[model samples]
Target chain A: MSGFFKSSIGRKYAMALSAFFLMFFLLQHFAINILSVFSPDAFNEASHFMGTFWAVQYVLQPVLIFGVMYHFIMGFILEIKNRNARVAKYAKNNGAANSSWMSRNMIYSGLAILAFLVLHFIDFWLPEISTKYIQGDMSGLLADSEGFRYYEELTHKFVNPLRVGAYVIAFVFLSLHLTHGFSSAFQSSGVSSMRKEKLQIFGKVYAIAIPLGFIAIALFHHFNH
Target chain B: MNLTLKIWRQIDANDKGKMVDYKVTEISEHMSFLEMMDVLNEQLVNTGEEPVAFDHDCREGICGMCSMYINGEAHGPDRGVTTCQLHMRMFKDGDTITIEPFRAKAFPVIKDLVVDRSAFDRIQHAGGYISVNTSGNTQDANATLISKHAADEAMDAATCIGCGACVASCKNASAMLFVGAKVSQYALLPQGQVEAADRVKNMVAQMDLEGFGNCTNTGACEIECPKGISLENIARMNRELLKANV
Candidate 1:
């Protein structure tokens, strides 16, 4: 009760809240990525705002980073505790009888998502900050004051098949992760009722939609000029 | 019916357990799971073999003493019943049934099919009771009016038999559902309102101290629960805990 966030259920609550927070960011990030496909100018304007705005950069990015890290830390912490919970495991235990396959294997999906995140940051977020702020090179990034290299860098990155394939696979894992994570998040923090049923249904849809949407976007950029 | 049984056998908590096979012939389909075991033990004793040791009492399933993890399920393949209530009719002739004790770090195997579930008792003692007035001047039970919805929910939560099936069914062996039910039973009633805040906090703390895993909401507990304890109880407990902390 004292360190509310440190308790078992409390840590789960924090993990759930963190997962929801990161899901919000994923939606926003997807919105920005899709904008590039429809209107590069619009994408550039949004990217410019996202990159240059003080609150978006200093305040939001730091918090978002912390959220991602917190989620990872809690995920592994729970995994370790869970492993130790069953010191003597069944020799012929069958898991598929009651629970979904994805629900039982969250750790593997999360690890895959974590791996993809490293590559994602390298391809996008890190380069964005490093080139502009750290190295102080603003060469062709702001070309003609009408274009942004943020869009150019996106196209440049997706032009490679290897990178696009990784994105596709990562999104697949992301979809699986969300299959359980989405609905489980609400349940962890005590969100239920007819709304809980609706959340479960919506969670299934979102688990497939958002990640598949990301994969489609990646492929759209990959095969096209 | 002649059935093959692969039962887990261990001398004590320190000895490594393994599945030992036995066969019982002319088994009646109407026999309860434990009754079938009785036949096997009689055969073992006649042959001067060590009979298997499994826990049971009030074989109708009310006592919650039967703790067999039969054929990968906590209470055999049947839903909403303990192993003792499970009948031989559920199995076919020549079928192989694997029986083992509920395995968890907190519930160490005491023998063949019995585990030390006193961890639950300790947890209950930690905060599963209400302060009652035994003096002659106690107030009337009807002095307080509780909503029907709350009363029913409390009753439903109170139906848990401390069976530990939830822990057995869980991949992580988490006891969130059990603790949730205990906490929710009191959380919904007026008699329990006085100590509500401390009850949730202390019960959850005791659960953690018992070395139970965190609830990842896999939900096998609710699904396999004999009383059909809802996962919503866990949600209620989480909400109660958060409210208490705040």
Candidate 2:
């Protein structure tokens, strides 16, 4: 394990595996969030289903959280190690502008995504899980007796131009982050082939389309309200 | 033609280098970039000042020894040409060109524009060779019929002179193009396939050990490369690396 961590192949595997894990969450999260676009009640139903699933809430939730933490920590540690190695090897300024701009700014973009994650959890997860389910607060947004207020809060937040604008901005940053991360995740995962070329095109489309969808929903709610 | 040079001057590896200005007059346009530098050195020698030190041999661009970062470019402004192939005509009479050595932790400065590129040699030594034993040239040259396309591609990959320009031109100082070319040259041919897995694994391991950064596939290395080595080679190496691991 130590030798694997120290090797290039090891690092690539770690990057790929972590990215794959994160991507799983991304797909599920997007699926859940897309519900809000169809109907506020539909999103509430999905949230209630998630909250009521004892197996998911007890077993899968902890595992998913572990996966997220592992992915984030490993990605950051490997990036730092790779950076230090590069700095020590090249002490001059000759090769500063030849690579992709996204590669150079991965860490910064990652931090931005991380910051957005915190705000996202506060806006969505905390209220849905803590305020409604845990604390049993049946207020304006959490008025549903079924113990699910995700859609109400989401619609209410999107109805506010400022909140909707923040979501749009965050999604834009997420798209930018995905532009590089999508292809890079594949490469680091040791999946570089003609398959990757197809995947790259798909990755680019997904990176753009998903974020745009989220933005569209936000704008729709803001305008309709 | 007269030209002003802002050359980097460092006493040793420990010294902090700075751009020192020098003026050279009566330069010929036909002279190669290095020959122009030679003229400047001759002038400095006559004036009892130390000559600007740089690496060059063969002066034919094939040797890969003429490494220079000129005016924010590896091997000057000429595309698909080494510094030795770059002529004085590329610059004007009043051009203030900044000349510096390749900068990377793997490539340390030796003097003015000279650097130690032995790290590349070390990486190559690590696993860049096929372990076939030569028994007095027993095999005929025509014994193996490589396809025309494969032969051409292999040769194209083999065209890398190991100049360190890839590292010099990369933003992260990544040696992906250089290492990729080396790996591709071997991996494409049957002669190199016997040790293909080990070769890629070892070479990539060595490349990381030498402290080169990751390949971002930005296409800059391909553009700045004097030989026009493709980024496809890096992709090929990535494919090979995946195969080796799995």
Candidate 3:
């Protein structure tokens, strides 16, 4: 019902849904990117398919963009409303006494991730869009050589130490963001209590492993480039 | 015990409040926190000064009327206890303790250390009870056999004293734990089945209208709750709402 979506719990439910979508997208994206570390040819093949496939390009990409935007916009609205809930703040709130620092500071970590997203978009997404759509180059080929453009471009981007440092830091923030967010999404989605402990354990593993994998990729390309 | 207290002072709701320092000496370590406050109030009355105003009813902690943010925590440093039940022995001698009223847009300050928690009453009014005729036609006891687990869960949920500590301790000032407890106490029982959907919908709508924040699942509420209410109640409420909407 329309009333459900308009309620506070409804808004949080929407947020959790979007978060799940984005998190799933991150997993698939990481899966493809990590291939570059193992085998550049496989990564190139996968990237080429994902880049040129009509369903992925037209349908999934747009949905992915919408999901990311929805999560951020809803997050901001919730943050503002929550801030307004307390007109006056306590002189001393020992948040660490009752909750984890990561849980208390989701907005800050989200902002950090958002900043990293801007950099990421500029570094990779923009160029990919410009090349494929604006320049009308569907061929996943390098102009200078006879090899696939995906792997070379991926390696080239990580050659800069500063960029790699920024990326590593961003992945760390992403890890922190996931530390609380992973299980929280399920909780918001109305998961039962019996499975919560297992979800938490799994959430911890995914939260740390995925970002650590991404960091390894960045460091690998940076050092081995 | 000798203690310095920095307690919030406000004459009325509209007035801006500030912390005023007072020293109390020769206080017994076994004195309850409210008794310590009473001692300070006695001192103030002797000097022709207005004493700090606070809310308290049953000193046994069952009433949930005593609310204070002591040393930056709801219900003070002690776990599973309300402010009235917090003993002075928890603090060391010569310590300076800060006392504050619960702060939330929904829970406005009526006076020093007292907030208007009638918003909770409004939410309760929305749908916290089940309506049944009791004009000499009440059902016999044990008419409906409920599972012991279900009864236990319902009783656990019912243990909530309507204290606003969950909201006070929450970083976002969310009332989900309180509402969740209220909803679960009904949802787990067969008597609450008839209007379960309407109850969740209306209560949540009223909760939003009251300007309480949404739950972010930080679990501070469970930790700070005097009755040890679980976050499972919240998840159950979420499920009930989802089911109601569908």
Candidate 4:
């Protein structure tokens, strides 16, 4: 395992596998949220279902959290290791000042995304799990007058301009993160075939589309209300 | 054309460097950037001042020796050409050009604009070669029948002169583009396939071990590369590394 981690291929494989887990989670989360735009009933049902699912709450949630934590830790560890290794060997002045802004600020972007995630969990997931599971306060204004909860809460939040704007800003950052992350994820995974060109195009489209989708939902609710 | 040069000056690797201003009144527009520097050095010599030291051997741009950060660019403002090939015509009269050595922790200053890029040589030494011995009676030249497409791609990758421009042009001082070119050149060729996994693994490890930064796929290195080596090479190397890891 140490030898594999030291090897380029090993590092790439680790990156790819971690990326796969994150992407899978993103897709699932997006799909679930997107339902709110079409049918509140569907979203509420799905949210309740997810909330009640013991397997997800116990087994999958821990795994997902582990994936997120490991991904963050390993990414930094690898970057630092690579950096230290480079400094040890060469002491040459080769011009590298002209490179792109994104290349230089990847760590910063990642940190921004991580910070967004923390806030996101606080805003939504914390209240969600705390109110539902911990306190069992499936009480007043939590569920709508019609006994619907998730959709009502989402629409209420979207009605507020500040909340909607925050969501939009978060989505924008997500798009920026994805723009770099998408291509890099593939490179890390070692998947650059002729298919790479296609993947890059797909990655860009996905980067734009997912964020746009979230923006669309937010704007739709913001405006319709 | 008359030009004012603000060149970085340092006596040794340990000395603090600064930009020293110099003037050259007569320079031919046809002269390369380095040739123009040569004219400035000649003027400095005539005035009993020390010549501005910069690296340049093959003014033809193939030696990978001419590394300069001119006016905030890796090899001046030119694209796909070394500083040795950059002509004076690109500059107008009265241009105050700021010339500095490439800055990276991995690439320390030697004197003036010169830097010690022997790290690249060491990284290459790690695994950038085939293990076959060069015997007097080796196999014929056509022993390997590589496809035209692969051969062309390999040749394109092989064009990297190890000038360290990729590192200089990169924001993180990442050598991904340079190492990618070397890895892809060998990986594409049948002669290099036997050790493809080992080659990529070793080279990339050596690259990181040398303190180069990570590639962010920024595409600046591609644009600034004197050889125009593609970022696809990086993607290719990444793919190879993934497979090797798996």
Candidate 5:
């Protein structure tokens, strides 16, 4: 087990597994968030279930926290190791011709995503935690009217142009990160094959589509009357 | 033609290398990249200076012995050819060609233009070959009919000469292509079925133990490989490793 963590492929396996978890989390989060745009009642009900469920709070949340930390930390460690792997760089490196820009610059895009996570946690996760644990004022968090707190808080957050711009830009970076990372995770996990082009196509579509959907939600909220 | 050569020079493994410039003139276009270096070495020998050291044998490009990172590309700029097969016509008369050894943490510089590639040998020893009953009458591998596509893929993978070009060209200095090709060569063939699980696991373990970096799937290895080994080999290895893990 110790030897597995030290191995390069093993480290990559961890990354692939964690990334898969995060990808599923992204899809789930997207679904819930997208619901708020149309039906706040459904959104509130789902959010209530997600928020109040003891198994989700205790079990899955901890797993997600660990997964996020593990994925992000390992990414940085791999980046540093990769840098040290090449002690001396080429005097003239034509990396563009050899591979995709996103593939080579994974660390940069990853750092950007990490930065975005901080703002994300502060905006959403932190407030939910405060409402649940710190203040212990659950009723203060509810807005069951046509003016749903679920919709209201999200729309209010997007009303700030800078914040909306940041969200849009972060999602753009997310797309870039996933452009290489999506297919790459499958490649690392051995889910990809030579005979089938499904993974690659699915990867590109997901990379583009998911981020675009997130951007749409952000924009839709910002423009909400 | 006159050319300015910027070659890496170092006395030993511990010593730091610096690019030393030299002039080689009146070169023929038909001369190979190594022959051009030989011409420069002859000039240095005629003078009172120490000649440059480089690795080369089987100058026809089969041995994978001729390793050089020339002008940023592994085995020079010519596609699908090792340093031994690269001709002078690829360069202009006044070209300033910068030559350096392959740089990877796993491949420490032994001297000028030569690094230790024993890591690859160790990896190969780990699980690169199959255990056959050579002591007794063995089943001839040729007796069985393999699909042409599989055979061709195996042939393509078997073409890897262990040149370390993949490591040199990769940003992360990953040896995935080298190990991938070796693993794929056997994985695609029927004879390699018995120890397939152990082979994948052992080779990958050895590869990681060799201080090599992880594959980012950059495809640099295939682009710069002298033999044009396909990236599908790496994919096959990944599949095999997954199967092994399962």
Candidate 6:
């Protein structure tokens, strides 16, 4: 079993597993975030549940953090090793002739998404942590208002045009990353070729729709705020 | 056709190579790419200069001996053909062709355009064969009934001639397609089932030890392959490896 994790295919398989976990998490995250546009009350309730539920806080959140870290660290390790394999670069490499740009430039897109994640954590997660743990304010409330603080915080972040622009750009990069990554995860997971074409179609839809939905949510909050 | 040839020239493995320009005039378009190289070499020999060395044998393309990265592509710009099989008709007059050896850390350039692909042989040595006994007590050839689909897919995987085009065409210089084809060629058959797990594990380990990169599914290897080896072979090998481990 240890040997399995050490082999090239094994490493790829492990990367694929982590990617699958993160992609699923992204879907759920989008699902909840989109609720802010339709109904802020429901969004706040969902956010409060996810933020403070014992099972989520004590169990899944740690696993999600580990998954994100593993994916990033392993991706960098693989990229470095891959670069070292060819010490001499081709004098003229026509990469566009065969592979998609998104497929070849996954690392750059990932880095962009990573940058966005830092911003995301600062805007939401850090404040939430401080409120719950440091301030011991588990009421999920506002200082001057009677309503939950989650929706207010969420909408307030998008009110700034510059922040909204950055969020939109990050969502575009996320789309690009997912365009290759969704089907690629299956290929890395050793899924057979027969079902691959259908999965690719589904992957395309999901890649485009989820990010577009995120962009709409951001724009809606920015305009409404 | 008249063309300017910018060919890589190197004294030996230790010497850094450079492209030397040589013009060949009145060349027939019907000539194969290697034949044009022959003409250039003959011109150099007549001029008291050492001819550029390149690997080629069985100019028909099955030997897999000929390997050249022409104009930023393995096996020139033509599809489904090795360098030896490429013809001058693919180019026009006044076209300047650039030819270089396949580049990879594992495939060191031996001379002008000849790279040492012994790393492939080492990978094959690791676990690319079955353990069938050939001591005159061999089982009947028709004993096992393989499905037609399996046989065809295995044959497709087996068509890989071991040329390094896949590696050269790959941006990462990955040999996953080669190893994948080799693994699939065996794993698809009943004869190769006995040592399937060990074969994939050992072959993959040897491939990594050769310093080849990992596959990113760019599909370049499949497109540039002389035999049109499908990307399916790669996915199949991935499945085989996973099945072996789990």
DockQ of each: 0.77, 0.32, 0.87, 0.37, 0.52, 0.78
Cα lDDT tens digits for candidate 2, A87-200: 433223433445566666767767777777887788877766776567875442445365456666666777667777777887887788788888877765546456788998
lDDT of 6: 0.92
lDDT of 4 by residue, A6-57 (tens): 5544665666687778877888888988998888778888887776778987
Candidate 5 structure quality by residue, lDDT tens digits, B141-233: 789899998898899899999999999999999999999999999999998999998998899999887888888877788899999987777
lDDT of 1 by residue, A1-225 (tens): 457787899999999999999999999998998898899889888888888888998999999999999999889989999999999888667677778889999999999999999999988888787877898764436555645687777888899999999989999999999999999999988986557997888889888999988998888888776
Ranking by TM-score: 3, 6, 1, 5, 4, 2
DockQ order of candidates, top first: 3, 6, 1, 5, 4, 2
- Candidate topping TM-score: 3
> How do the residues B97-214 of candidate 2 rate in per-residue lDDT, one tens digit apiece?
8887887778888887899999899889977887765888667868988988778888999999999988887765778889889999988888899989888888888888888766
Candidate lDDT (C-alpha), each: 0.89, 0.78, 0.94, 0.79, 0.87, 0.92
Report how far off residue A103 is in candidate 2 (Å).
3.4
Model 1 pairs in collision: none
For model 2, what is the error of residue B243's alpha carbon versus the real structure, in angstroms, after optimal superposition? 3.1
RMSD of each: 1.6, 3.4, 0.7, 3.5, 2.5, 1.1
Tens digit of per-residue lDDT, candidate 4, span B1-246: 888888888999998877788888878888888888888888889889888888889789899999998887788887889999998899999988888887777888899889999989988998888877678777786988999999999999999999998887665577988998999999999889899988988888888777877665667788889999988898888777767766
Q: Give the alpha carbon lDDT tens digit for every residue of B52-171 in model 6.
A: 899999999899999999988999999999999999999999998888899999999999999999999999999999987899999997888999999999999999999999999888
Runs off by more than 4 Å, candidate 3: none
List ranges where model 5 is wrong by over 4 Å. Answer: A1-6, A39-42, A139-147, B135-138
Report how far residue A113 has shifted in candidate 3, in Å.
0.5
What proportion of the true contacts does each candidate reproduce?
Answer: 0.75, 0.33, 0.79, 0.40, 0.55, 0.75
For all candidates, what are the clash counts?
0, 5, 0, 23, 0, 0
Candidate 4: what lDDT? 0.79
- Misplaced by over 4 Å in model 2 are A1-5, A20-24, A54-71, A86-97, A131-141, A144-148, A159-162, A189-197, B26-29
The candidate scoring highest on lDDT is 3
- Model 5 earns a TM-score of 0.92
Residue range A1-225, candidate 5, lDDT tens digits: 555556687788899899999999999999999997888778877887788788998999999999999999999898888878878776666677678899888888888889899999999889989878998855435444443355566777888989889989989989998998988887776653653367788889999999999999999888884
